[model samples]
Target: MADIRVLIVEDDPFIAMDIESAVADELGDKAELIVVGSVAEALRATASRLSCAFLDIDVIGGKTFDLAAALLQAGTPFAFVSGSSPSDVPKALRQARFLRKPFSTREIATFLLGAISPLKPRRSRNH
Candidate 1:
């Protein structure tokens, strides 16, 4: 299988580490995880190909709405992992999945699994 590039945008170190660990455990060697603490860093990370992303609503630079929009435009799948209410996410981006704060590792794993599954066919096509 092709490497699954995963982007994680979160400001809290503990939460970021937790998500990273969960992703690592879930994807094992097939995933390339990039964890960033700010919207700027997250935006910069988007210069390359990403199979999927997990974003926190509030980051160092700002809310992730712009970054989310960019990812959507790029046809990359992403989900919001934030304590904020789902209503806080604009209606346009509401289609993306939302995982509330204090989420479990199981939740992260499930999201990753779902996100990467749809990309497998695309990866096969590319090869």
Candidate 2:
């Protein structure tokens, strides 16, 4: 399989570390994890190709709605991992997968597996 680049947009250090550890546990050396704390940082990281992303709803800069929309438009697989109610998300994006805060490792692993599954076609990063 090709290398997997995963983006994690989380402001809290501990949560970022937790998500990073989970990504490491799942993909080991096969995955390159980019952990960022703000929407600005995340937007910058979008310059590179990404396999998938885990986004926190509320971050250092603001709500992740814009970031989520961009990822959606890019056809990148992603999940919203946030304490905020799912209803808080924009209506158009509510169909996307969502993982509530205090999630289990298994949940993360499952999402990662699905996101990088061979059956799922990867979108080009040209846009």
Candidate 3:
């Protein structure tokens, strides 16, 4: 719903910023963006009714798939973003939206808007 928020799980500082900018550019003050680099940080941030998530398939210091599973178990919707190929995502996250690296801001923004919108699909085209 409208109360839902976004949580971004990315290990790379640069990538995280990119994701943040994309979301901010589109949503502006419409939603909140929480960025965490590791699994533990993600857990703490995920302790709410998250609208959706933009998660990296591989984190520098933790298992990205674990984070995804935890989010799913918590009943939160999520999308997987990665610099690598689709094969990089764990089996569980394979069903979620897969965003390749070097994605456009418009693509990520659209995905966030669509994901948060109840009537929209959870996935979108690769950018």
Candidate 4:
């Protein structure tokens, strides 16, 4: 859990900062937040570990569904954060979590926290 990395794909500076703070408050040292404002940056960040992700539908590349596709292929859990109820998300991501704009810090935390797996299984030592 201490090595977890959470990605946030948001274009708004203020919103990104708020989400960053919320994630820190929720996961503390258990996870680190990696924020990107565009699909290119998000794609680059994917090269590293991705425990989970929160993607804003309308980013610098127009939207984040393409980035979402990459995440799905990599088996990384993710959710959508949008100011509008976008009708353009891919069918596969329809079941993904959606947090509307103006959402509370608690809601943000809850969405990301829910995606995290429980603690890793302990290794057994044989004598």
Instruction: Point out the worst 10-residue segment of candidate 1 by lDDT.
Output: 118-127
lDDT of 3 at 85: 85
Using all chains and alpha carbons, the TM-scores for the candidates as numbered come to 0.90, 0.90, 0.81, 0.86
Using lDDT as the measure, what is the rank order of every candidate, best first? 1, 2, 4, 3
Model 4 C-alpha RMSD to native: 3.9
Candidate 2, residues 1-127, lDDT tens digits: the string is 3478899999999988998899899888877899999999999988888899999999998988888899999988899999999999999999888999999888888999998897345669997
Show pairs that collide, candidate 1. Answer: none
Model 4 per-residue lDDT at 24: 92
Worst 10 contiguous positions by lDDT, candidate 2: 118-127
Alpha-carbon RMSD to native, per candidate: 4.0, 6.3, 6.2, 3.9
Q: How does candidate 3 score on lDDT?
A: 0.79
Model 3, backbone clash pairs (residues 3+ apart or across chains), number: 1
Whole-model Cα lDDT of every candidate shown, in order:
0.91, 0.90, 0.79, 0.84
Residue-by-residue lDDT tens digits, candidate 4, 1-127: 3578999999998999998899899878778788899988998999997889989998897778888888888888888888878466778878778888888999888877777745333448863
Model 3 vs. true fold: TM? 0.81
Q: Candidate 1 lDDT, tens digit per residue, 5-86? A: 9999999999999999999997777778899999889989999999999999999989999999999999898999999999
Clashes of 2: 0
What TM-score does prediction 2 earn? Answer: 0.90
True-structure RMSD for candidate 2:
6.3
Comparison by TM-score, 2 against 4, better one? 2
